[model samples]
Target chain A: MATVASNQRGTGSRLKTWWTILKISLEERFVYRGDFALGTLMRFLPIITQVFLWYAIFAASGKEKIEAYTANGVVAYYMLTMISRAFSSMPGLCSGIALQVRDGEIKKYLIQPIDLLGFLLLTRIAHKLCYYVIALIPFTFVFFLCRGFFENGWPEASVLCAYFLSLIMGFLLGFFMEASLGLVSFWFLEVTSLAFVYNLLNFFLSGHMFPLDLLPDWAAQFINLLPFQYLAYYPAAIFQGTIEPNQVWQGMALEACWLMAFIMIARIMLNRGIHRYSGFGG
Target chain B: MTGYRPSYLNVFLTFARNSLVRDMSFRANFILQCISTISWTVMNIGFYLIVFQYTDSIGKETGWGRNEFFVFLATTWIINSLVQTFFMPNAQQFSELIRSGNLDFALLKPIDTQFVISFPRVDWAALSNLFVGFTLLCYSLYQLTTKAENPLIIDWRSILMYPFYIGCGTVIMYSVMITLAATSVWLGRNQTLYNFWFYITNFSRYPMEIYKVGWGMALWVFFTFIIPVLLVVNIPARIMARPLNTMNSQMWQLAGFAILATVACLMISRRIFVRALKSYRSASS
Candidate 1:
């Protein structure tokens, strides 16, 4: 009985520690409110170019639907991609980890009681929360302006639930995958080029550039086997109602599986990296 | 000391040599960066190839057929690579120089401040993009001449004009970039400089014909007459790929305006840069 009570107390204190980290991270994010808002709005500017390009292409093709996507559907897909990317993108996370490892800042995490992965995950969550809060108006305005493009209109409640669930899984998957890549810095000492290559691949394969279905059938099948699609494409396709209902659940399960695998990979890398680390300066 | 003037050519050569040495010192990084850049270009080509599978041209009678569009893409890569290799790294560091008071040292030097600031760091790895662009351009030109329904006539006039327009495009882009960098002197930290650069340059990547309709017309007008980035690749690509007689009178006028815009952009950017320098409050102060 006494041991069970102590275990409960320990869990409570752990939650409190995470709460403090989350609060501080949120505070840091909100410090530059105006800049944050402007940055978010500026991100949407590229979509204008996209809309024109697709419009021109569809007009040239003289097709109501090319590759099973109408002009409106393609535009709507891109808009949804922005939302998915907002949840999954981890700017500077990889480089920041490399810097910490190289500069001996990782030593602090060793001495502290905090788990490095948990801390990073919490900080990222706070960042996303702050981004959504500040970017709510811009997002709403953009979506409202382009509402006509959404020919299918609002999705069913069950699909909507699955869409949101897939997005949450995507967030986790993106974090762990990037964290694993970052932890490679322990051995490499410099991962900038590697990170660049990874980002280039991610940008294309993740459907941030265009829909995966645009690729040849073989190429699409090959890329779909990889985890990159979960980053942006899967959630957007879910919202577009392109995937069947059962397939949506299957995709969610697959995404969850990838997330778990990446989590294990990150934890393993961190452990191995810590074992290899040696801080030089006193 | 005041009478001794160093030759600018010699100084530029020295900077180039020094930058090459620095780049070679990090040989692995240089190789990896080159690989990364080439991979990106390949992927970009692949994406466009997939897009073109569904259509004959980029727009309705826009004349940017597959080979013609590849010419445009290659031109973009060429101009972008030159600008990035020579100017981007230096311009990016302009704000840092102000913050660190390194601009004081630059000002104390006997050479032209702008020249020194712009040419000190040459990212040699970026030259890989130039190589890839040239290769693609050559292959696409071959395809146009031999395989297309109407074979392109490659004339000596176009052969000479292409490089000249590429030079003009590079200068105009550099002018825009340096002017943006100069604002860092006043803004103290222009962290959004690269983002703004990307957003502006993204428009130039596609053919300008896409912007001829609807609200896109507003953007076309703004970026063309006001900023004139639209002419950077469009004029050169059109000149190379399309027959001269087929070019509308408006295109000829725009081509003429490109040269004027190049000179005007250079002069205006120089003025803005000097004015911004005058406003600089160095870190020591």
Candidate 2:
């Protein structure tokens, strides 16, 4: 390959490659069509189980409100949680990075022209964009099918729009954090322990199953310091109106702050990790 | 050198040993895995309790109170975890072995390639799910005995039938994994089946009865003919409840399903793999 001068074309050309990466990933996804159909349906089973649990809670309280959340509000909260979860890659991307490093495939990327971290992060974004579009179908059908399953008002829509952006921010925060942790593989052959601790931290802090409001104030404050809340809670809070729309922008701004800090941390980790790669891989 | 074939017994032992060694190498992985998986099960158990702490029952009709839900969930958890340990990993890797052109590596061995690939790795941590499920069963049983209008003790008849139920469940789960793994042949090079299967396996974690009867029947077919998971879950729960009659075909269905699933998985996989091998030019292309 001839040396090519880096110029304005570099940015344009890189963006073009990212789009091409998307096409390749989509084509790659087609091979698993069998899974796409049955797998998508199977994904909803957990929500069904969870909904029943929430239903039990509503029934037991003998009142529709639990800590100021109405029955429909609670249901809608989980439905959004489930939908956003379908878009999540925190645990998966973390584990994938570890596996790549364990198998020495990360070395392959060192020789490549494009940035490995950039390519990986973009690949997941593109893949999830496609996968979640498929998830949106059943999600919408379920949203409409259940009677009294309402999506609040214009305030709610605006909140949801903010929530959607926060969701992207959440994914980024998670991706960068995990990628940074995965960089630990440069020293350790397996990062499964670190990955496990991270995942447990994710479930408890992100509010994947239950919202942050459900936790005690101190519990809430502890997770608030971490980026995990920005991953699931901020988005979920906006969806449930738990934090109130009057203050929703604060959550959005917080999400922006977490994402920026995470990205910078990831770059530092990557630079230091690559220098220590050592090449004596599995 | 080219025409070697080992006995099926040898293949089984080799694959079993290989997976065991791989798992043992990461000694800490087993403990971490067990803790995480158990934590996940505990999370759901906590969720189950939280729900039952309220409304008392669903829709006021099914009226499945807490003990019943625990019993049902315990059964689901055990079957779900057992299947995860037994078949899911192998199936997930089967797709990978094909996609990465690693199938050739598996095939070149003296043993049957399918047998070698099928059980090449085991998740020792997933065994924690099995332990948690058993504990859940014991807890549920105590709850049932104390809370029941009539305290029902564990009966021998039910105990005997439970294993039968578990047997059927394993058969069905294994069959589902094998069929999807076989799809990698035609798929050429895609790990989508692996991810798709992992997502679906979470289905067994929930109470299967939540599905409407029509959809239940559809899932029954999907689980049996397609996914066939109830081969592990529904059967175990039914046997513990009592022997099946026409009222609940789960027990009878499992009996038949196990044999049918096992044979179907073996034969169909053999045919597809042989055919796939005939056509594949492999990585050299």
Candidate 3:
């Protein structure tokens, strides 16, 4: 019992250190308050353009439902997607990590007592916290504006819990996947094109452009088998209640599996990269 | 003044050649960039393929059927590729230039500051999109002519007008990009320029008819009159895709409007750029 208490105390202090880093990260984010707010709001402009396109599609088709989706349901899916994106999207994180690896800045983490992955994850958590804090008002404004478009008002508490869990996993999965991509910089002198290619695939495969459900049956099934769906589509589907209650647990398990797989990939890449790393200059 | 500033054409050619040499020096990176751009266009095509499987047309009232819509998509790629190749890299560097006080050096140059800043680098890899877009446009036109009930008439006149309208699109896109880039002077570090640019240009990719609904009218007027991007892709795509009977008067009107909008956008953006320059304090200041 005494040993267990000591172990608990050790874990507590470790978390406290990370929590302090998170606080500093959050404070650093506040330096660009106006940029944060304006950038978040402006990102919604594409969604508005998409909404117009969908409105036109439904109007022209004169169909209340398209592929098991009502217009309102579709709109609801997009709104939920914004929330999922808020959690999953890590702007410049990949390139930032890649630059650190390329420029030998990763040596600092090696020399320091801090763990790089732990530091990055905590910093990311802080970023998301501050992002949502700044973005909540705009999100509320847009949600209220889109209230009329939601056929089902609110999801069940159980569904919300699952959805929230999926979002957290999505965040982890996104981070690890990009971190794995960034670790490639240890081998390649330039990772810009690789980053671009990754973004192109991610933007399409993650269902940021449209709902994965809108894809053909085979395509949707195949995408579901991949990890990208958990990043955006699965969480939105859970919130939309498109996935049944029984399937929610299964989806969460898959998300967890993907998160684990990505974490492993990142670990392997980081190990190999650090082994291969050569300093540019003394 | 250095023999009439080396002639604008000579200056641009020199910059372009220098950029090409720099690009060729990194052969593997250049090839990868080409692959990346082509893959993005292909993925976009795959997306539209699934969307079109559900609906016959993008905007049914506007007659942007699969082939016609592809034409519009192709036109978008063409114009966007040109902008990305020639201007985007320069615009992105504008903030860094200001931060480093390199703009002062640019101002000291004998040639036009805008010209020097805008075309100092040409992204050769983005030209890959131009080839792909052109091929897609040709294929779509073939499908339209052979498959449509009323086949499109590709006259010599329309053929001549196509490049001119494409030039208009490029100018308008350039104006908007430079104007956004100039905001860095006042905003300290305009890191959000790329996102804002993407958001604004997203409208130009689709048929403008979609923006005719409820709140879209306001957007339509805003993008049409204020930003004038609605004319960018729409006029060129319409001229290429619409039937000859419908194209006669509407074609002239659209062509005229595109020219006027291009000039207006250029003038307004130039004024904004000049004003931003006046407001700019050096890094030391």
- The numbered model that scores best in DockQ is 1
Off by over 4 Å in 2: A1-75, A82-148, A151-161, A185-189, A212-226, A247-282, B1-14, B55-64, B97-117, B120-125, B146-149, B199-202, B213-228, B241-285
Best by lDDT: 1
What proportion of true contacts does candidate 3 retain?
0.54
TM-score of candidate 3 restricted to chain B?
0.95
**Which residue pairs in candidate 1 have backbone atoms (N, alpha carbon, C) closer than 3 angstroms, thus clashing?**
none
lDDT per residue (tens digit) for residues B99-146 in model 1 = 788899999998889998999989999999999999999999999999
Candidate 1 lDDT at B174 equals 97
Q: Write the residue-wise lDDT of candidate 3 on A5-69 in tens digits.
A: 98889798888888899999999988888767877777677877778778777776767888768
For candidate 1, the per-residue lDDT at A254 reads 77
What is the per-residue lDDT of model 1 for residues A180-261, given as tens digits with 9 covering 90 to 100?
Answer: 9999999999898888988999999999999998999999999988999999999999999888888888877777888889
Candidate 2 - chain A - TM? 0.88
Give the proportion of true interface contacts each model preserves, from 0 to 1: 0.83, 0.23, 0.54
Superposed model 1: Cα runs more than 4 Å off = A1-6, B1-3
Give model 3 RMSD, 1 decimal.
Answer: 2.5
lDDT of 2 by residue, A17-129 (tens): 88898788877756655556565765665665455445545654577676757767776676667656655555467677777777778887888767878988877876777
Q: Tell me model 1's lDDT, rounded to 2 decimals.
A: 0.92
Pitting candidate 1 against candidate 2, the one with the higher TM-score is 1
Candidate 1 chain B weakest lDDT stretch, 10 residues: B147-156
